[model samples]
Target: MSDKLPQNRNNEEVDLLVLFDYFGKSINRVINFFYKIIKGIFSFFIYALKPFIRNFKLIASVVLVSAILGFIIQKTQRDVYTSQMLVKPYFDSKYQLVTNIKYYNALINEKDYAQLQEIFNISEEDTKQIISFDIHSGPENENDKIVQYDEFLKSIDSSRAKNISFKEFVENRSIYSGDVFQIEVFSHKKDIFRSLEEGLNTTFTNTYSVKKMQKRDSLISIERQNILSSIKQVDSLQKVYIDVMNDEANSNKGSYTTKDGMSFIQERTKTKEYELLKESMQLRQALSELDAQKVEEDVYFDTLSSFQDTGEKYTSIWRVYTLIFPLAAFVTLCFVFTGKNIIRFIVNYEA
Candidate 1:
């Protein structure tokens, strides 16, 4: 029995060993398959490079042609010149003390659209060409302030005026606000500066007129309020006096001797009431006059603000073209180079 037990144990051990060898062989097969796949991919790359390796002359010719094309593209394309203008924007010192002065001034006294178009040498329809009028306030850092100022300057129009492009408007839009306001202008050439300068000057001068109109409007509003308050007070006084006279007349209606004193009191009250009523009427008239003045002032202010805004926008319009043209040129060059290289590579490989 013991001998048979030993023989059975040895047989079980041999069987376990055989199973382990079969599992190892399966793993080896998978590794060999992956290694062959890796070798095949490496061989494909080597095969692909065979053309470039076998034809050194062709490769050199292609490189030379690409370099020459790149040089020509770099040279023949016109360099986009950028000119910048700086501006400082100023708010009227009395802007806070006086409300809507700038707004009203622009509305009331500025030239009409036709006159502005003639002055700027532009058609009224061209006004829409103006894009941005960004106002920046109080940058803490000097460099940042200058950068902001430059950005503001770039926001104005840069179209041609009287056969010249408008680059001068940037410097012309400068406002004095003790480090607070700045304007910058950008253009392709310096020659446009004079025309831009003139346009900006005219536009800003008109803007000042709008500010004045706004101030007038503010004053009118104050006057209107004062007149309204006075009218209300006079009306209240008249009502009080009338009420007192009515009470006196009612209390002494049937009393014989006492009626004389009551009549005298009522008479005095009636006269005072009439005087108050007349004063109230005068206040109302004054209020009406103030209202008319306010209307006029408002109209003037609106016109001025609109004109100034339009002029500012007109000066800023050129930045768009300035930004777009260079970028477009760069993109065109990139596309040309990439397309040429790709087509050359494909044709050569196919051949």
Candidate 2:
């Protein structure tokens, strides 16, 4: 048995040694693999940079010339002025507003100065100065986003709504999801924006929006009539209860037993005046709200802020051609050098 024990211990020691050897080899292999990847990447970058280094002077000259040309072009370009208007559309007028803004842009692109002249009531010369029109969702705070998310959840299936988080909902919402919008007009003439407003004002009154407003007004009228009828009924019941109480107070009968057809039970159940009064107040309040709603949203849209009389000069980083040209030149040179080298390699190949 002792001999067998020594032999078993020797076998276990050999197995452990073999396993250690296998693990050591794997670790070395992994380290070599990573080292080779890093070396290959470093060599590739050096090879790619060699062409730029060899033609440094030529590249510098071309970039400098391009930058100078771009600077001159930028200086010669006319200045653009921009102004913004904020509006809150009712009765789904925002859809028409966005659509009309796009139409205006299309007209500008087509250079239909005649149609533009009629739209803005501006002269041909003024219409020529018009550049572009843009619209986007206006500013909103965190509370507004949360309210919108809550409304969206209510509008969808409960099971689907459970899967949608507030962050996801906000990220997925489109421009039309917003209640307010900002309309921007770009033009060469600084004072052109204010004139465009009269045209934009006309955009909010589309056939669909007009019909929607009419439908809303009709619904409100019906609701108001129903609430008025309920109020009248409540007042009549209240008057009857008051008269019954007054008759009971004035009478001085000792028995005071009320007869219901033949039998007398001597039970006097009072009217629920408090509950009726509460219901009457609620109905009247609802009527007031309906009237207020009609008064508030009488128009298709409300102009939260109008365009400025004179627009401010518009500037953008993309318009900085001095920087743009040099970058473009460098990238073009890189592509050219790469293509030349590839063609040379293909021609000189011995396969």
- Tens-digit lDDT track of model 1 for 1-351: 999999999999999999999999999999999999999999978855565566557556655555566556655643232222333322343233123223323422453445444555655554322222223332345565455456555665544233322344333444332334222332223233344344544333346657776777788778888888887788777777778777876776434445456432324333476677778888888878877765544432121111111122123323344444445554555465557657878889953
lDDT (C-alpha, whole model) for all candidates:
0.50, 0.92
Misplaced by over 4 Å in model 2 are: 1-35, 153-168, 254-269
User: Which ten residues in a row are the worst by lDDT in model 1?
Assistant: 301-310
Could you tell me the lDDT of residue 218 within candidate 1?
80
Top of the candidates by TM-score: 2
- Model 1, residue 274: displacement in angstroms? 38
TM-score for candidate 1, residues paired by index: 0.32
